[model samples]
Target chain A: MAYKCYKLESILTINNLTKKFGYLTAVKDLSFTIKKGNVYGILGPNGSGKSTTLGVVLNVVNKTSGDFHWFDGKISTHDALKKVGAIIERPNFYPYMSGYQNLKLVCKIKGVNYSKIEEKLKIVGLLERKDSKFKTFSLGMKQRLAIASALLNDPEILILDEPTNGLDPQGIHQIREIIKQIAAKGTTILLASHLLDEVEKVCTHVVVLRKGKKLYSGRVDEMISSNGFFELKCNNQEALVTLLERHNSFSKIKVENDLVTAFLTEPMRSDDFNKYLFEKGIILTHLIQRKESLEEQFLQLTDNQTNQI
Target chain B: MLRLLNIEYYKLKYNKASRVLIIIYFALLSLMSLFATIKFNIGPIKFHLAELGIFNFPYIWHFNTFVASLLKFFLLLVIVSMVANEYSNKTIKQNLIDGLSKKEFILSKFYCVIALSLISTFFVFVVSLILGFIYSSYTELTIVFSDLEFLIAFFVKLLGFFSFGLFLGMLIKRSAFAVAAMVVLFLIEIISYGIVCGINKGTELADRIYQFLPFKSLWNLIDEPGSRLSAVKEVAAQIGEDLSYDYSVRWYEIAIVLAWTALFIFLSYRLLKKRDL
Candidate 1:
C-alpha cells in the first residue's frame, strides 16, 4: 500500500486519554497521533473539551484514565516538555515583569540562551515593546508575546489553544500569519481552536470533538462528507428544517440560525433540492451550493451535534 | 540547584512589593542597634539599655538573634505573596508547561526560603558583632565568638518559620488566607497548650507534649535572653530569686525545628506534585 511506503516518526501519541471534573467528563476516550511536521487541529465547539484534551497532554491537568506518550516514553518526560513549546488558555505572564524579563524566565526554564530571546521577540514584532511590562501590552500584543515566548526554545512541536480567541480581526490576522510562517518552516503544530475557519485555513488534519466526544478525526479533505453541501433558507425555517430532516434525498441535514445545510448522499444539485422542497409546499428564499471546505467541515460538526443531541 | 535559585532570584527581583518588604525587613534588622544609644538620666540615677549587658558576649549572640527573629514575619509575607502571585497570574501552570517539573518548582521555593534565612542570619550576625564591639566589655576574640550557636539557631528558626509560610502559600494559594492560616495555627498551638496545661494542673505534661510542637520547638531554639541580663540576675539574686535557667541554645531544639522545616518542605512538594496546577 502507498501508506506503508513511507514511515513517519510520531512526535506525540495519546491513547484513550480522559479527564473528568466531578461527574462531567471534559474529554473521554480521546485518542490521536501526530507524526513529525503534522499541522493537527483539534476542532470543536466552545464547551467541547478542546482545551481540556490539550491540558491533559501538557501535564497541567491530570487525567482520569489512559495515558499519552511524547517521543518514545509512556509518561511525559520533563526533557520532552522542554523540547516542546505550548501556550495554554490565556497568555499567562507576570504582569509586573517586562516582556524581556518574562521571556528571560522562560529561557531559564528551557535552558536557552538570553540572546535567543531578542531573536524570537523580533519575530513577533515585540522587540520594541520588550521593555514594557506585560500588563501594559494590548491583548493582541500579549498573544503575540506569548507566541514569541513559545518559539524561544526552537521547539520541536508547538501546541496553541485558541490562540486567536478574544482578538480583533486584525489581531487574528497577524497571529495567523505568524502561525503560518512557522508552519511553513515544517514545524509540527497541534492547534486546538473552536473556529472552523481557523482549522480550515491552517490545519492539514483535524479532529472534530463535541461535548467531550470525538466525532471525526482525519485529514481536512476526508472531513468533507461529499463533493459539496447545499444550504437553503426559507421563511418558515422551522418547517423547512423538519421537511429536510424527514426527506431522504440528503445523507445529513441541520438548521443553524435560519439556514439549513444538507450534505448530498448521492450527489444532488441545488435546483433539484429546491424543486423537491417546492413540491413539498415550501418555497426557497435563499439557496447556495457551498463548495468551500469550510462549509463542508462546519456542516459536518453541526450535523454531528444535531445527531448526538 | 544554583539555576533554580537564580530563577527565584529574578522572580523576586522584579516584584515591587517583595522588594519593598525585603528592604523594610533588613532595615528593621539593622535598626535594632538603635536600642543601644537609648540612655536617659532621671534625678541622680541613669538607666541605659547597653549598660544592662545585653550586648555582652557571648550573650550578645542570643540577644541579637532573638530580637532579629521577631522580624521574620516581614519576609514570610514576601514569600507567601510571591506564591500567591504565581497563582493569581496563572504563571504556575505556565512554569510547568515551560518544562519545570513539579519537584523542581518546589525545590526552587525551598531554595529561596533557605536563601532568605541564610541572608537574614548573616545580616544579623554582622549587626550583632558591630554592636557588641562598641558596648560589650568582654572584647576578647574567644569571648566574641564563643556563643555563636545562637546564629545557627536563628537560621533554623527562620528556615522553619518561612517553610511553614511556603507550605501555607501552596496550600491556600492566597496570601491573605495563608497569613490568616498562620495566625490560626499559632492560636491553635497556644490554645491547645493552655488546655493541656490546665488539665494536667501544671506544665509538666504540657511542656513535655508541646515541646515537639512546631512553634514550641522554634521558641526553644533561643530561650528568651532577657532573664540572662546581668542587671536582671543581680536584682533577682537580691530579691531571693534563684535565677537558674537554661540560657544556652540546645541541639535538640535545633534538631526538632529542622525536622519541622523538612516536613513543611515535603508537604509543600506533595501539594505541588498532586495539584492539577
Candidate 2:
C-alpha cells in the first residue's frame, strides 16, 4: 500500500507525564508526541503502563503529574476533551439499551449532531445491527459499537486502548481497516496494544514503555531499523558460517535448523562478506538485511527492567 | 441543553424500562384502586374509581389511598431502577467520558426524574379531576378549587421525592445498594408513620415527633386544611394561627426541598467529577 505523506506536526504532545496508583508508579515520566494523522502506538508487555498512559491522556484516569496538549497546541485535553473521544479498556454499554441507543447517549453527552451518529455506525459497519440490545451483541459486534460510540462526534483525536483486544481475526482486520480509513482522512489515532505485529503494521510512530518508563519513542521504522541484522538462508549452512566467521565485523551468530542468522554492528560490511562467500563456492540462497521485529526490539530495549521484559 | 433533553427523552422513550414502568405503575395503581373500591365500603357514600385514566370508575380521588396502597412503593422502585441501571450498565461513566460536564450529568438525571414524576402525577391529576366531576354529580359532595390546589401540592411533593431519588443515586452509585436503600427508606417512613400515629395513638410527644416524619410533611401538603392530617395545621399549631394566615404556600417548605435537591445534586456532581470509573 502506498502511504500518504503527512505534513508532520505534533497533534498530541505529552510533557513528562507520570501517574501513581497508591505505592505503584503506573506511568513514570513518560513523554512523547503523536504527529498529525499519525497512527501512533504504545507497545509494551502487559502491565507496562500502556493503558495507563492512554488513560491519563484521555482524562478518564488521573495523572499524578504531567501535561498533554492536542492539535498543535490549538487545543489541549485539559479543557478540550470535547474534541477527543476515547475507549480505554473494555467497551462499556447499558446492556439493556440497543447499540443505537447507547451511541445516542454518547452523542448526547458529547453534544454532537445526532445525524453524525448514523454516519459513524455505517463507518464501523454496525448499521445493520444498530438496533440489537448491547447484551445480545457478540464481543466483536460490541467492540464495533464501541468504536462507533467513540466516533460519534467525529473527534479530531481518537484514542483507543487495545481496540482489537476481544476481536476475532476477521474482526481485528475489520477494525484495523476502519481505523486506517479514519486516519487516512487526517484524524489522529493513538493506539495502545501488546500485539507487536499489529502495531508494526499500523503504527507510523511508536513509544515503547517498559515498567512505566519510556524505552523508545520516535518513528516506528527508525526504532525497528536502529539495529539491523543479517538473515541468511543457505543451501550450505556450514560453508556460510565459515565464510562469515572469517569476518570480525559481525558480533553474534545463531544457527537454527539449516539457516544462519547473524547480527552486525556495521551493516555496511555485508557486501564484502557476500563477495567473499560467493568466491568460496557457498551458494547464497537468500542474503537479506533484516530489520528487528517490533517484538525483538521491545525485548532488547526493556530487558533492563526485569519485570517488564 | 434542549438537545440534551431531547436526546435523553428519546433514550427514555425507547427504553423498555420507561414504557414498562409507566404500564406497570398505571396497572399497579389501577389494581390498588380496584381493591379499595370493592373492599372498603363507607356507609351510603359512593366513590369514583379510575384505573389508568379510566374515568368515573368507582372510587373518589384519593391521593392518600393511592399513597397508602401503591404509589410510594412504585416510586421507590422506579427511582432505584433508573439510577441503578445507569451504574450497572456503566452508562453513567460512559456519559462522563463522552464529555458531559459533571453538573450536566447529574442535572440530566434530576430533570429525568422530575419529568417522570410530573408525568405520573399528571395522570393522577387527571384522575382526580374526573373523580371530582363524578363525585359532584352523583353525591352531596361539592368539589372545590381546594381540590385543584392538590395539583400544586403534588408538584412540590414530586420535587422532594425526586430529589430523594437523586440522593439515593449519589450515596450509592451501585444499583443494589441504591435500590436497597430506597426500599429500606420506604419501609422506614411507612413504619414510622404507623408507629407515631397508630400504635402510639395519643401521646403528645409522639404527635410532636410525627410533625417531623420526612414524608408526613409531604402528605400534609395535600391534606384538607383543617383536618388532623394537614401539614398546614401542624405548622400552624406549632407557631400559632397568626403565623398560619401570614404564610401563603410555605416558602420554607419549598426552600427546604430546593436546598435538599441542590445539596444532593452538588454531592452527586462532585463525586462523579472526582471518582474514577
Candidate 3:
C-alpha cells in the first residue's frame, strides 16, 4: 500500500507531567508528543500509569505538575476539545436509556448537532440495535456505542482507553475495522492498550511505559527491527549444535529438546552453514528468515520489573 | 446551564428509579385516597385525619397534596437512588471521564432534584383542585391562588428539604449510605415529635430540637391553628416564659441549608475532578 504522510505537525505535546496519589506516583514525569494524523499507541503493563496519563491529558484528572498543549490550531482546551472526543475508561451510559438516547446525551454535552444518529450507529455497525437499552448490550457492543458517542462531534481526534476490553475474535475484528475506518477519514487516534499485537496492527507510532515512566516511544516498525533472522530446522540437531558451539559467530544460542537456535552475525551465513551440513549428510528441513515481532521488542525494552519506575 | 438542565431532564425521564418512584407514589396515594373516601363517604372529603394519613392535608385535594404527602418522600428516594445507582453500577467515574465538567455534572443532579420536587408539588396542587371540584359536584372550581406569603413559606420549606436531600446524596454517594441518612432524618423527626408529646410531657430538650429541625419545619407550610412558632413557644415556655422556641422559619436556617449543600457539592466535585476515573 502506498503511504500518504501527514504534515507531521505536533497535535499533542506533554512535558514533565506527574500525578501522585498519596504514597504512590501514578504518572512519573512523563513527556512525549503525538503528531497530527498519527495513530499513537500507549503500551503498558497493569497499573503502569497508562490510564493516569490519559486522564491527565484529557483534563479529567488533575496533574500534580507539568503542562500539555493541544497544538491543532486551537488555544484553550474547550476549543481544542471542541475538535476532540474521548472515551477515557469503560463505556458509560444510563442503563435505562436506549443506545440512541445515550449518544444523544453525549451530543448535548459535546455541543454538536447530530441529526443522523444512525450514521454513527452504522459506523460502529450497531444500527440494528440502536433501540436496545444500554444495559442489554454486550461488552463489545457497549464499547462500540462508546466509540460511537466519541465520534458524535465528528472530531479531529479520538482518544480511547482499552477500546476493545472484552471481545471475541470477531468482535475484535469488527472494532479494528471501525478504527481503521475512522483513521481513513483523517481523524488522529490515541489509543491505550496492553495488547501489543493489536497496537502493532493499528498504530503508526507507539510509546511503551513501565511503572509510570516512558520506556520507549517511536515508529512501530522501527521499534521492531524489520531486518530478518534465520530460522533453521535440521534432522541432525546434535551435529548442528556441535558445529554452532565450535563457532562463536552468534549470540543467544538455545537448544530446546531437538531444536537449536543461534542468531547470525550476517545474512546468508545460514545458507553456507546449511551447505556444509548437507555435505556432512545432515538434512535441513526448514531454513527461512524471520522478522522480529512486537512482542519481542516489548520484552527487550521492558526486560525486568526492577528496571521499571 | 440550560443544556445541563436538558440533560438532567432527559436522564430523569428515562431513569428506572425515577419511573419506579412515580409508580409507587401514585399507588400509595390512590390507596390512601380510596381509604379516606370510603371512610368519609364524601367521594372527596375536605379534611379527615383518617384520609389525611401522616402528613398534613388541610381543606384541599390538589396535586400539591399528592405531591406533599406521597411524592415528597419519593423525591428523596429518587435522589438517593440516583446517587447510589452511579456508585453501585460504577458509572459516576465513567461519566466524569466522558468529558462532563465536575461542576456541570453535579449541577445537573441538583437541577433534576429541584425540578422533580417542584413538579411533584405542582402535580399535588393540581390534583387537589380536581378533587375539590369532584366532591362539590361543580366542574368549575378554579385552582387555588396562593398568596406571596404562603408561596414564600412553602418555597422556603420545600427548598430546605430539597437541599437536605441533596446534601445526603452528596455525603453518601454510595446508595446504602444515602438511603440510610434520608431514612434517619425522617425517622428522627417523627419519633422525636411522638416522644415530646407522649413520654416527656412536652418538656424535654428533644421536644425543643424537634420544633427547630428542618424536617419539622415542613409542617409550618400547612395552614393549621397551632403554628410551628407556637410549638416552639410550648417548648420555650418549658424553660422560661420570656423565651419561645422561635417556631417561625428563620433566614439563618435557609443560609445554613444552602451552605451545607454547597459544602457537599464542593467536596464531591473535588474528588470527582482529582481522582482517577
Candidate 4:
C-alpha cells in the first residue's frame, strides 16, 4: 500500500495565549512556536508565567483568551497531545504506587503497550527502584519517574517545566544528561526553567520572559552573539573614551572606575579594535575582550523591563 | 467504558487507603451473615432474632438489602478520596497532560462508582441467599424470587450515594471537607424536615415533601424492614401503637434517586470541566 507522509515544521504554536487568575494575570498574551527538532527553552525567573504558559498549552490551566495548536495549524486534539509528552511544575503521581505502577497507569492512558514501561523506566534510571512507592522515592527519583512516564509513548515533542527546580548537583546533572539524550534522538523539546546556565547548556532557541511578558525570543547564539560591550583599562581612560567616541565603529562609550567600556556599532574583530586603540597612542595596561553572557543579557532584559514598568 | 474502568482499577488497586477501605467494606458486608446465629433472652422477652421470620423468603431480600445499604458509606469514602487524591496529588493535571481528556477522567470515576455498586449488590445477594437457606422456613423458588426489586433498589441507592460523594469530592477538593459537606447536607435535610413538620403540627405535609429530598429518597428506596418484624408488631400492639407504615419499595422513590445519581455525575463533570487544574 502507498501512502502520503506529511511533514509539519511547527510542532507547536501559540498565538496570543493569555491566562488570568481573577485580578492577577498569570500569563499575558504570550506567543511562541516550537519547530521540529528544536530544543526550545522558555527562560524566565520565578512567577514570570513560564509554568503558566506551559500549563495553558497542556490544557491543565484554562486560557482566558487566545489560541494554541499542535502539528501544522490544527487544533490540539488528544491525538496531537498524545504525541506531546509534558510535565508541568513538579512530578505528580499516585503517591502510594510504585514507579512501575505509575508508568503503567500512564501507559494505559496513552494507549501504549505495557512492555514499554520498563524500557522507559530504564531510560530514567528508575529501573532499580521500580517497585518502590512514589512517596518513598526522593524528589530526584520522582522527577525521573515522571520523565519516564512522559516518554512512554515516545512523544514527538516533550514539554518540561522547571524539571530541575529542586535537586542536588548530581541529580541536576543526571536530569540534564537524560534530557540531552532524549534530544539527541531527534525529539523536539520545550523546556521552561529559571536557570540560565541550564538553558545555555541544553537549548537551541530561547524565549525570555519577565512579568508575564516576552522580552526576547530568538536563537540562543543570536542572543549571546549580539554586538557586546567590552571592558578595558588603560593609564589614560579619558583619552581612550574621547578618541573612540569620534570613531564610526563605537556607538556607546562609558568610563567608570578608571575603565572604559564601549559597545561596537559595526562588526569589527577585537584585534582590529585593539589595533585602532594602539595606533591612537593610548597604551593599554589591561585589555579585556568579553562577549555578552546569557546571564548579563537576561539580567539586562528583565531589568530594562522592570524600569519601564 | 472498559478502558475507563481499567484505568480506574489500577489507580484504586494501588492506593493504600482505597485498598484498606475496600477490604473493610466487604468484610463488613460478609459479617452480616453472623446475625443468623444470635439467640439470646432479654428479661421476660425470650427471643432468637433469626426465629422471628426476619430471614424468611422475600423478607430476607428486604432485610438483607436494607442492612447492607447502610454499609455503603465505606465505599463512599473510597470514591470520594479517589477524586480527592487527584487534586491533592495533582495527578489529574498530569493525566490530562498524558492525554486523558477531562471527560474521560470523569467517566472513569463514574464507571468506578457503577462497578462498586454492582459488586456490593452481588455480594448482598449472595449473603442473603446463604442466610435465607439457613434460617428461612419457606423454601419455594417463587417466594424467594418474588420481592427482588429490593435488590435493584439497593444497587440504585449505592449508585446514588457514591455519585453524590464523587460530586462532593470534586466540589470540595478535600477528603475531610467533602465528607463533612455531605454530613452538612444531610443535616440540612433533617432540619428542614423538623421545621416543616413543626410549623404544621403534623407529619402529613412533611412526609409528602421529604420524598423529594435526595438523601431521604435514598432511604425511601427500601423502607425500614425492622418495623415489619413480628416481634416489633407484638411490642407495638402492647403499647397500643399504630403500625401502618409502608414497608415496600416504591418505584417513584427509586426514580427520584436515579435522577439524583445522573445529576450528581453531570455536576461532577461540569465541576472538572470548568476548573483550571
Name the top lDDT candidate: 1
lDDT of 2 by residue, B145-211 (tens): 3434445556666767666766687668665677678678768877776776666566565645644
lDDT, candidate 1, at B101: 86
Clashing pairs for model 4 are none
The candidate with the higher TM-score, 2 or 4, is 4
Compared with the true structure, what per-residue lDDT tens digits does model 1 show for residues A1-309?
A: 568527878888999988899899899899989888779998888989998888777878889998898987754567789989899879999999999999999999989999999999988988899999999999999999999999999998999999999999999999999999999998999999878788787888889888888888888877765666788888988888788777776677877888788876667777777788889899988899976566555665778678878
lDDT of 4 at A174: 95
Tell me each candidate's RMSD, in Å, in order.
4.0, 6.5, 6.1, 2.6
Order candidates by DockQ, high to low: 4, 1, 2, 3
- Candidate 2 docking quality: incorrect, acceptable, medium or high: acceptable
TM-score of each model, in listed order: 0.91, 0.78, 0.79, 0.95
For residues B117-161, write the lDDT of model 1, one tens digit per residue. Answer: 999999999999999999999999989999889999999999999
- In order of the candidates, what TM-score does chain B achieve? 0.97, 0.67, 0.64, 0.97
Candidate 3 chain A lDDT trough over 10 residues, lowest sum: A1-10
Could you tell me how far off, in angstroms, the CA of residue A281 lies in candidate 1 after the best superposition?
19
Cα lDDT for residue A142, candidate 1 = 96
In order, what DockQ does each candidate have?
0.72, 0.38, 0.32, 0.83
* Runs in model 2 lying further than 4 Å from the true structure: A1-10, A72-79, A111-118, A231-248, A253-261, A269-271, A277-289, A307-309, B27-70, B136-143, B147-153, B185-254
Off by over 4 Å in 4: A1-8, A73-76
Candidate 2 whole-model C-alpha lDDT, 0 to 1: 0.70
